[model samples]
Structure formats: C-alpha cells, structure tokens
Target: MELFEMCPVCQRVCDVQTRRMGTFLSVEQLCPHCQFSRLWNSQPIVRSTPAGNLQLSTSVYVNGESFFKLEKVLKAINLQLFEYDTFLRHAKMFIEPAIVSNFKTSQEMMLRRLSEEDKIIPGGDLWADSPGHSERSGSHTTMDLKINNVVDIPLFKSDEVGGSCQMEKEGLERGLALLQEHGCLDDLMALIFDENFVDPAPFKEEILKVTITEDLCAQDERPVKEEVIESFVTQVKTEAF
Candidate 1:
C-alpha cells in the first residue's frame, strides 16, 4: 500500500487501483501529474490461469485441506481471497481430473505386474468414512499381497448402495470388477478379507479368512487387519513351495 502511494516515474502521490484474487495481486497506477501509467502483477500468469490461484488449489487438494477451513482463517485476518465457487471450479476443472489421470497411469502399471504373476492372492478391506454402521461412505482397497502394492480402490456412497452397511459389499464388487476389467482376475487365486468382512458366500471358494490373534498382532506390530491378511499370504506361499 505504501509503495504504491507515490508514482515512481512522476515522484508524486497518486491513486492506484488494486485487484486481488486468492494470492495474486494486480496494481495499476495512473499519475495525473505526468500522465505516467504502469501496471504490476504480484505473480506470473500460466496460460489463462493465475499462477497463485492454481498453486493454492493444488496445495489445498494435495494436502487434503478443505477450502472452508482456509476460508475461515482468511476471513479472520480480513485478507482478500477467492470465493468458494472459484475453489470448487479449480478443483473440478484441474485438480481432481489430473489426480484421476495420474492414478490411472499408475494403476495400469500395477495391473501389468499383477497380470504377469502365476497366481495373485489379493487382500481386500473396506474403510468406512467413520467407525460405525451409519457412515455415509466407504472405500474398498485391494492390494497384491505378493508385492504388498495396492491394486485397486473403489469408493461408494451409502445412498448409492441403499445404506452404509451395504457400502462394503458394493465396494468389494466394484474392486473385483476393476480387476476383471484389467484382465487380472484370471490370475486371482484367493481373496483375503479382514476380521470385519463376512458373508463370503458370493465367492466362498476363493476366500481365505485369517484372524489376527493377540500373539500375531504383537509379533507383526502393523495395522491389525493388514497384518492378518499378509500373515495369511505368507502361510499360503510357504505351503505352496
């Protein structure tokens, strides 16, 4: 504000017009004394997008931070910032699409590796948005137990599947479909499930249930569900050879 008070060319006090968008600032000075005019930008523009605007969107999405939370902080300090609609537009138009594209590229590489295997014993689990039956959404993750790499993750909303309890089954179905779509289902030898998983009746022949006893938990020192699945995989591999 102080720097813009006096025009540099004319060396006289002048009125400056300022525009702010998120972290980007633009200042235009038009001095009446010498008719000097100048426009300044705080940051560079990338394509049609302001660099600061894109950066803010990228940082918020990648760090798992919500725009509303940041908005509250900015409001408290009376700082100039973009609106929620603009953030949402940036996320939908840029952030989420790029994330999905990158994920697909990585997922295809993993699927190729899994396809080359003679047998794939993938571990599957469902994570609810909350630790309860009435959670709004859930995601099922399928990991290749042999290499300990994630193969697929399918997210489901409760409303889409009737209820939160139904999310697990829906997610598992979607995960299996993903594997099938990628031609990796043929090599699937067995599917391991966590303690919470039940009703393997749909795919009982390929299901291997492993429980993480207290001793097993103490020995593995990993997440209880993952340790149980990996222990099952280890035992299967040992017996096969």
Candidate 2:
C-alpha cells in the first residue's frame, strides 16, 4: 500500500496511514504541519470554458502623458487593460490599511429609527423595519463605514513616480520582445484599445465621492471571498512562472 499521498493544502507528500479510531481505509492521509484532515475522497468535477471564446470587456483611463506610451507598453507585454484591472483588484486586497486609510475616510454613523409602537408618523412602520430593523423590538446602534478618498491621494507622486515609470518601461520592453517573438504585436494592438483616448479627470473626481457603508448587524471581520484570492494567486503565479 502507498504510505503517503500528496497533501493539497501544503503541496507536500504526507503520511497516508490512518491512526485515528474512526479510520476504516488502509490509507491514512495527514498533513504534518497544519494537521489538516486527509481524506480519501473522489476527485472533484472540474468544468472549464474555452479560454479564447470567453469574451470580456473592460476599460481603464490613462493620463495624457502616459496614454500613447502605455498603449505601446501594453502591446509589448501581451496584456490588455482588463488584465491590468484584474491584477490591480488582486493587488488592492493585500494593500496595507495604513496606506489605504491615508487616502480613505472611516466614517461612523448612528442609525436610529422609530419602533412600531413609536410610529407617530404615517409611514413609520415602513422605515422602522427598513434601515435599522432590530429583531428584539427596540434597539439603536451606530454603524461604521470606510470609503476611499481618491482626491486625497494623487495618482502619481514625485518620489514614487520612478517606480511606475520603470514598470511601464520594463513591461513594454518585455511585451515588445514577446510580441516580436510571437509575431502578434500588430494584430493584438489592433484588437485592443482601438477607441479614442477619453479624458478621465472628470470621471475620476466622481469616483472619489463614492463611499462604503458597513452593515452594523454584520460581524466585525467580513469573510474574504476565496475566488478573489485564488484568481489573484493564479495571476501572480502566471506572471512569476
């Protein structure tokens, strides 16, 4: 009998012999580090869609200074604006809250609504169960909301601007090399960003005004979606590998 099987959590060869009381199968799998349960289970059904046929549409705005250069750079890198958007959404998840707070405002609001008994107005009952509905008859509490203040943070800082400049230069150099090797530069560029460059200054200002309100009833720590993390990890791994 095989003594071990690959541990999915740690990606390591682990003991397969079961020692626990409820063990029935000859094979017992166990992770040494995290003690995650090793179970002899059926392989999950994997469903995949055709990559090329899956169409995705997205748009991003670039500053005038880097507009043309960015287009050239993206073509060289074998990536589109949508791919960058995917990467950025992933990157933002891990960004330090201190950095986030610097450009964001944390707001706490107290929501108090009249109870069914306190419905002195005509539609008090409607609103009573609306915003601050409490199961225990009468309750009032404050909810905290955090919002990213885009205006507080400049898109490009003088000191950190070099990093962005270097990344674009390197991305273009690499992308161009790949395109030249693959002979897809002209074709890919023609397909991507074919539209005229629209100014983003006005829209960016509007986005900065958006705010996030926290649900008071929800637990303090919200669950992070696994799909988001997995997609982020896959993107990083693809880039690194």
Candidate 3:
C-alpha cells in the first residue's frame, strides 16, 4: 500500500494498492467520501499503414496537449493545425466506407475468371494465318489474370479521427489567435500542408510535375517541437472539455 499516491485519472490523493497483472503493474484506488475512481494501466498505441505492409509506431497523448507533435508533423506537410483537426475527423468517416468499398471491389474482381484475350504470348512462338487469326494474331491464346493484391490507397491511408466541425472551427480560431499573439503565423505556414510554403517550387508549372520520389514525401516525420508543445499545453490549461 502507498499513501498520498496521486491518481492520474482523477488527480486526487488516495490510499492505493498495487497488484501485478501478468508482467505489468495495475493500480487501484478508492475514495470513499468522493465517489472517485482511479485506475492506471499501461498500453501502447498501434497504427497500420495504408498498404497493410508497414506497422507505424504511434504515440498516444492522453490530453489534447499531447497531440502537438503530431500537429507539427501535419504542419510541416503544409497542413494547418486547424485543417489537421478537420482532416482527422473526416478521416474517421472515410475509414469505414473506404474499407468496405475496397473489399467489395476486390472480391468482385478476384472472383472473376480470366479472359482468353488477356493471356500472355510465348516468346518463341510464331503466329500463323488461320480463320480465327489475323495478320497481327499470336500463335497461341492464353488467359492472363492479373490480380491486384494491394488494397491500400492514399485516401485510405490519410484517414483521421472525427470531431464536430463547429467545435473545430472555434479551436482553430483560438489557435490562430494564440499564434497571432505570439507573432508566429508567418512562419506557421511551414507547419501547414502547403507545399509552396514548406518547399520551394520554381514555378506554378513545376508544382504540377510528379515524380516517384515525391510521392514518398507524403509520410510525416516531424516531431512536435518542444516550444509548440509547451505553448499548446499552456493555452488549454484553463479550458474544460
């Protein structure tokens, strides 16, 4: 038993007992006078990439303050903090529908039989003129079925959690006000999802040019900088959600 152990959940002092659950320790505390409950368990957050080929390491922030690093990464990608909030909400909606549609499409395509016309021609085979063969006909007909095993797409991978749009707008306004107060909005563009702001685009036409290497840039790697994290934590300190 421990005395004056602050419960992380309710932030109350209590006489708590610790018990082992498998390899981990769990804490249970009772506050008889206040109907207060506090339980602490350690769990890690996990995320799978769109291709289902990679498992990304994710960090969980219990409070809104913890998401600052994620916010910074979004900002580096030309996504505004406010927009990132909106995107997260929309992503939650997109997940269910997107996964279902993709699965159905794959099922329909996979269950279909291969067509004769799609068959591959042997390298050494020569074509012969016949009733069914034309001048451009091949020596043999084979049915080639091409199966697309990859189901993850960009839109599906970019999904986010959903929140009320009205609340989001207010949050954004507040965030903007805070940024203005701190005089960081100009540099803030780098934190947003604007390619033109973060990276240099020679011209408008250059922006349209697509290269295989550029596609990989979609993945965010920026860690939420400490200053921004502290600022966000301070901003919402008094607000209750």
Model 3 C-alpha lDDT per residue in residues 1-241, reported as the tens digit of each score: 4443665456667677775422234577776556576676433312312211111111222122344576577568864333345335434555446657877686345324221223311111222333331232222211121433321111211012132223333334443444334343444444356533454546756867855464565677766699888988888985744
Ranking by lDDT: 1, 3, 2
Tally clashing residue pairs in candidate 1: 0
What are the TM-scores, per candidate, against the unseen true structure? 0.62, 0.15, 0.18
Record all residue pairs in model 2 with backbone atoms less than 3 Å apart, i.e. clashing.
16-28, 17-28, 18-28, 76-175, 76-176, 77-175
Better model by TM-score: candidate 2 vs candidate 3:
3
lDDT of each: 0.81, 0.37, 0.41
Evaluation by lDDT, superior candidate among 1 and 3: 1
Model 2 misplaced stretches (Cα beyond 4 Å): 1-164, 186-241
Cα lDDT of model 2 by residue, 104-186, tens digit: 44211111111112211110011122233222121122111122111111122223324323333333343334333433333
- The better candidate by TM-score, 1 or 3, is 1
TM-score of 1: 0.62
Please state every model's RMSD to the true fold in angstroms: 16.2, 33.1, 31.4
